[model samples]
Target chain A: MRLFRSTLTALALALPLAAPTLGLATSAHAAPYTIDNSHTSVLFKTTHLGVSPFWGRFNNVTGSFQYDAAKVDASKVQFEIDVNSVFTADKKRDDHLKSPDFFSAKQFPKITFESTSVKAGKAAGSLSVTGTLTVRGTKKTITVELAKTGEGKDPWGGERIGFEGSFVINRLDYGVSYMPEGLGKDVTIVVAVEGIKG
Target chain B: MDPILALAFGVVVPALVALAFVVVLRRPFARTARGGETDLPAPWAAGFGLAAAYGIGVGLLLGWPDLPPVDVTLVAPWAAGVAAFLGLIRDGRVRGAASGVLGLGLGVFMTGPIEDMTLRVGLIAGVTASMVALERGLARLSERLDPRGAALSQIVLVSGAALAVLFSDTASLAQATGGLAAGLGALFTLGLLWPRAAVLTRAAPAVAAILVTNLWGTTLFANGHPAVLAALTLAPLLVSFIPPLAASRRAILRIAVPAALIGIPIAAAGAFAGLRYFATEDASASEHATGPTDPTSPSAATPATPSGTPTTSGTPTTPGTSGYDPGYGY
Candidate 1:
C-alpha cells in the first residue's frame, strides 16, 4: 500500500508540466509586432474648392497588430492617430480648421481604429479587416481591404511584415459638411505599414 | 506686434475709455438721460460699463488704431449714423410701427446689387410703403389682445428675430441693419400693445442688439477696413447707453462717466495697432516685390525712362521696365 501511494504522488507532481507541453503543441502561432512609424505613413487626399485636389497627411501615427496565418481566426489589429498632428501647412486655415467650426480638436484629440474582425490571407494574398474608426467624437464601422506585401528577415535578424491598404470615407458623413458644394465629397485614405516582430 | 495681440489691445483700450466717459461726463450729460434712475448694483454697473467700453474699443480699434496722431475718420461717422438711427426710433419722434417697417424695407432694398443711389432710394421707398401697411394690420391684432398676451406675442417676435440673426448668413452691413430693424420693430410692437411690459419688451432688443453688433464687428474684422472694424466695435456700447441715460440721473452718470474714460483710449490704441500692422505688411510686400539691386551692375546703371520718355544714360531700370521680372537682377 505504501509503494502504491508513492507512485500516485509522483504521477500527480508530473501532471502539471505535461499539460503545458500538450497545450503548447496545439497553441496558435501569432507574431507580436510593434509598428515602425519612421518607415510607415498614412496619406489622404480630397477635393478642395470643387475643382482642385488638396493632399494632406497625418505625421504621428502609432499602433500594434498581430497576424497568425496558420490560425486566421486568432489575428488582431489596432491603430491610434493623433488628430492635432494634422498638417495642411497653412497657419490661418489650419487654426480655423482646428476650432469648433471644423475638427473641434479641443473636444476630440485622438482618433482610433480597432479591428473587430480580421480574416487572414493566403501567402501573398489579400486580407479583409473590419474595424471601428472613431474621429471627432463619432464612431463608425469600416471594412478595409489590406493587401499583404509579404514578410522578410531584417539585417538584425528581426522578422518584419508589411501591408498596403486603401479606404474611402465621406467628410460630410462625419459632420464636416460645411463646404460650398464645389469641393469633392469623397476623401481617399491610403495606408502603408511596416512592423517589426517583438 | 502680432495682429491678434494688437486687436486685443484695441478691444480693451476703448472699453476703458468708455468707462471713463461714464464716470467723468455723467453729471454734465444729466439732461440726456433717457431711462429713469433706478440705481443698479455697483458690480452690475461695472460689468455693463466694461461691456459697453469693450464694444466701443472694438469699434474704434477696427476703424482707427492710432489716436491723437491718426484720427479715425470713417468709422466714427458710421457709428454715429447707427446711433442716430437707433435714437430716432426710440424717441417716438419718428412715430409709429410704420417707421420701423419702413426702416427694415429700406435695409432690404439696400442689400440688392443696385449701384445707382437714386434707383436704390426708389426701391427702398416702395418697400417701406408695403411694410407700413403690414405693420398697421399687426397693430390692429395687438390691440385686441390682453397685456400678457401682447407681451407673449412680443417675446415670440423678438425670439424669432434673435433666431434669424443667429442662423442666417447675414454678415453684410445691410443684413445687420435689417436685423436691428426687426429687433426694434418687435420692441415697439410690444411697447404699443403692453405699456406696462416695457421693461420685459426691452430685454429681447437689448440682447439682439448686442449679439448683432458683435456679429457685425466680427464680420467687419474679417472683411472690412480697420477703421470700419473699429466703428463696428464701438457702436453697440454707445447704443446701450441711450436707455440708461434717459432713465435716471444715477443711470446717466453710470453710463456716460465710464464710457468717455474707457472707450477713447482702448479704441485709439487698438485702431493704431491694427493700422500700423496693415501698413507694415503692405510696405514689406511692396519692398519684397521690388528686389534689391546691385549698385555695380549694368542694369542698375541703365536709366528707367517713363513709358513715353526717351531712355537716358545712368538712369536705373525700374522693375516695370524689365517686364516686372522677379529674376532680372539675380
Candidate 2:
C-alpha cells in the first residue's frame, strides 16, 4: 500500500508538468488581431511651401498585426495604405492630385507599407518597416518609425491595442523631386492605429 | 481677370489649339490617304498646315506680344503640346481626344504643391500613368474604328502632348510629358518599332521645343539675360543631330545647318548671361531667403510649439516641421 501511495504521488507531480506543456500548445494557437481601419487613423502635417502649416489624413488603411506582451519577440505587424483615399478637405486640389503629376493611380493602383521588424515598449527601441511604395509605376522601399501605444479591452469585451508612430521620407528619394527648390523634400507621416482581436 | 486665371488661360488656350490641330486636322487628313512608294504629299501638307494652325492659335490666344514678361502659367500648355505631339507622331494615328483630356487634367491637378514627398510622388506618378494609359487605350479604340490612319495621328498627338508636359518645368507638365516620352520611346525602341518609327519625326521637334522652353523658363525664372537663354536653348537641338549623322550624309547636313543657326545665338546668349549673373552684385532679395531645414537629420526634430499642444498631433511637432512655405497659400 505504501509503494502504491509513492507511485500515485509521483503521478500527481508529473501531471503539473504535463498540464503546462498542454497549456503552451493551446496558447500557441491564439488568434491574432487585425487593424480596424474604421477605428484607426494615419495623420500627417507639413508646411505648405515652407510657410503655413497644412495637415492631412489618410483613410481606408487595413492591416494585420500580432502582438503578445509576454513574448514581445513574437509580435508581427503588416499594413497597407490606399493611395487614392488621401484627403485634406480641399476637393479641387485633391481631385487634381488624384490625376497625374502625383499618384498616377492608373499605373500604380496601391501604395503599400509592410513592417520588417517590430519592437513593442515605451523604451526607445528602433523599429523598421520595409515596404514597396508604388507611385506612377515606380516602387521603392520606405522605412517608418513605429511604437506601441498600449493595449486594453473595449467596453464591448473585445481586446484592442493602439500604436502611434511617425517617420520622414524624401519625395525625391523615390523619384518625386519635381518641385521648386524652395519647397521641402522631407515628408512626415504620422500613424495612429488601433487593432481589435480577430 | 485675376492674374492667376489669366495666366491659366494663357496656358490652356495654346494647349487646346494643339489639341484641335491633332483631332480635327491630323486625323481627318491621314484617314483619306494611304502609304505608298511615293510619299503622300496631301496628308503631309495637311500635317504641316495643322502645325502652322497650332502656332498661330497659340500666338493669338496668348496675345503673345502682350503677355507678361514672367508668365509662369504658359509653361503648362507648352509642355502638354509637346507631349500630345509626341503621342500623335509615335502612334502614327490620332488617338481619340484622350491626350488633350489627359493633358488638361494633369495641368489642373499638378498646380498645387503638397509638402509630403510620398503623397506628392504618389500623386504625380498616379496621374501620369492614368493619362498615358487612357491615351493608349483610346488610340487602340480609334485604330479599331479607322485602322489605316489611326496609328499615325494617334501616336503623334499623344506622344507630342505627353513629351511636352513631361519635360516641362512645371511638375504636372513634366510628369505628363516625361511619362509619355518614356512610354512611347520604350514602345518604339523595343521590337515594336515598325509603325511607331514615324513618331520619332514628331519627337525631334518636341525635343527641340522642350530644350528651348526649359532653357527659356529657367532663364526667366532666374531673370537671366537673353543671351544665356538662347545658348541654353540651342544645346539640345545640337545634340539631337548626332544620331541622324550615322544614317545619311544628307540627313547630317539637313540637321546641322539649322542646328548651328539656332545654336550660335543660344550659346552666345547663355554664355553672356552666365557671365553677367555671376559677375553682377545685384542679387535679388528673394535669393537671400533661408531655405527649408533638412528633415533627414535626427537632431532636426520639429521644434515645440508655444501653444502647449504638440504642433503636429500624434506626431513630432517642431517649427519648420511642415517644411518651408512659399507664402502663396492664404
Residues A1-198 of candidate 1: C-alpha lDDT, one tens digit per residue: 999999999999988768757775223366778887666677878877666888766656689988877765566789887665565643234434443334545445567899998886443567788889887556789988888887999888889999899899886555443332444668888998888888
User: Candidate 1 chain B: worst 10 consecutive residues by lDDT?
Assistant: B68-77
| Native-to-model Cα distance after best TM-score fit, residue B58 in candidate 2, in Å | 23
In model 1, what lDDT does residue B262 have? 33
Q: Candidate 2 on B213-265: residue-level lDDT in tens?
A: 43333323323344443334333333333343223346335423433433454
Error of 2 at B281 (Å): 44
Q: Which consecutive 10 residues in model 2 chain A have the weakest lDDT in total? A: A90-99
Interface RMSD of 1: 17.4
**TM-score for chain B considered on its own, for each of the candidates:** 0.28, 0.29
lDDT of each: 0.45, 0.43
Cα lDDT for residue B241, candidate 2: 37
RMSD of each: 20.7, 19.1
- For candidate 1, the per-residue lDDT at B273 reads 40
Off by over 4 Å in 2: A1-31, A120-143, A180-183, B1-171, B174-330
Tens digit of per-residue lDDT, candidate 1, span B74-171: 12223322322332233232333434453453434232434567865764554344333323322322333332333333333323332322222221
DockQ measured for candidate 2: 0.03
Error of 2 at A119 (Å): 3.0
